[model samples]
Target: MSVSHLIKHSAITTGILSLASFGLAASPSQAVSVDFSSWDKLGDVYTQPGEASLSNDNANFQDDSPQASGYYNLSGNNPEEASPNPNLQDFLGLDAESLDDDGQAYEGSAIKSVITAQAGDKLSFEWRFSTNETSNKDFGFFLVNNNVIKLADFTNALQSGTSGSFQTNTGFNTFSYTFNSAGTYNLGFGVVDVGDYVTSSALDVKNGNLEEVPEPTTIVGSLILVSAGLLERSRKKARK
Candidate 1:
């Protein structure tokens, strides 16, 4: 082949290769679908009308660092309805009768959503737990299919600056869980005033996501096949 023909063929090959690489690199990964609209107040948890909120503003809670898009807030306060959720009390291992006898109330605010996920799917979220009751056993919690997971408690949380009415706060933390079996799950986030209802506690959650684990071997194999086909087509065009 002449030098000019060699240069033209080489340029075409380089261009096609670059395009193939870009296509593979720029491909979006699969994300598990989360129905944000499905979020609703958990069973009969005691809360005022404005206690549960979904908003984009984190500054309202004095969080200097905000998260992407929006966040869910569940704040517990003095029982407005006095109707504590038995399910939540059971989850917390609190005796409702004993609490009532002691003049203490178990007030909670929680939001729950039903999600369908496959095995190996990972769910994650960023959360901050804040509270005003330093002496009481206020806490923040997360649940997967009724299995309670404690996020933070009054004793464990750091003495950071106030969050809304809460005098103490815990900085943003991350929680992630991988599904072990393919099925539907109930996801929950909440805060509760354990010993006293006089003070309040809040849980803030943002960037909730469920994502499918990528199979590197399969993805790489498919990309290779696609690149090979592209290269073959380019070779045929160059010949013409």
Candidate 2:
């Protein structure tokens, strides 16, 4: 093919890629949130990028056992009790928990998905971590990026009771993070048990959302405009 033909083809390909990156081409003002109302359905959340499985494990849902009110109970005994084999903090390459706590013992699950958003976009969710096994134990949410643990900005403090208290009436505690660039992000929500014992904590989360910013579209448009200009120049040169 001639150089002009190649330029035209390239421009067309780029424009299609730009549209694909936008996912649903939602208005910049709208934000997408994931929530669960019943054990059977999780609104707008998935385990994988393209698949529709909502729960990573079948035992994660506790609508009847704990009267969960549509929340996940991140317990250690989902499939079976964790052996407390390895200290989770060490396994995750994080500093050890405060010495006053039980050793690193993690028995939990995390839900992951490839979330699309632009630079400056904000993604957030609400969670409650409760454990009666305080005295140096906790659970938290981790945001994984590119297979690495990027942030652990939200974790619960040690509680004084065995029964976890759900803040459903007044709303759960909110955790938010902002994206610095536009692309696919490996977003994750997890719950963990930080001590060695059968006593487990619970991580109840709801209302996950991605608040998109409009800047990425502007960038894509500029690229298309430049590509169109180049294509025009190529056509003029070929005709001469």
lDDT scores of the candidates, listed in order: 0.56, 0.46
Per-residue alpha-carbon lDDT of model 1 for 1-240, expressed as tens digits?
Answer: 556666766765676565556444333347754543347664323233223322111222332223221122332222222235555455433444422422344556566767888788898777777765557676677778747687877676686754434457788888899999889887776666566434455676766678876644456546566666766665666577
- Give the per-residue lDDT of model 2 (tens digit) for 112-157: 5566777888877666554434243434455546333322211344
All models, RMSD in angstroms: 10.8, 11.8
Cα RMSD for predicted model 2: 11.8
TM-score of each: 0.57, 0.47
For every model shown, the clashing-pair count is 0, 3
Q: Highest lDDT: give the candidate number.
A: 1
Assess the local accuracy of residue 45 in candidate 1 as a C-alpha lDDT between 0 and 100.
39
Candidate 2 deviant stretches above 4 angstroms: 1-28, 35-102, 146-171, 216-240
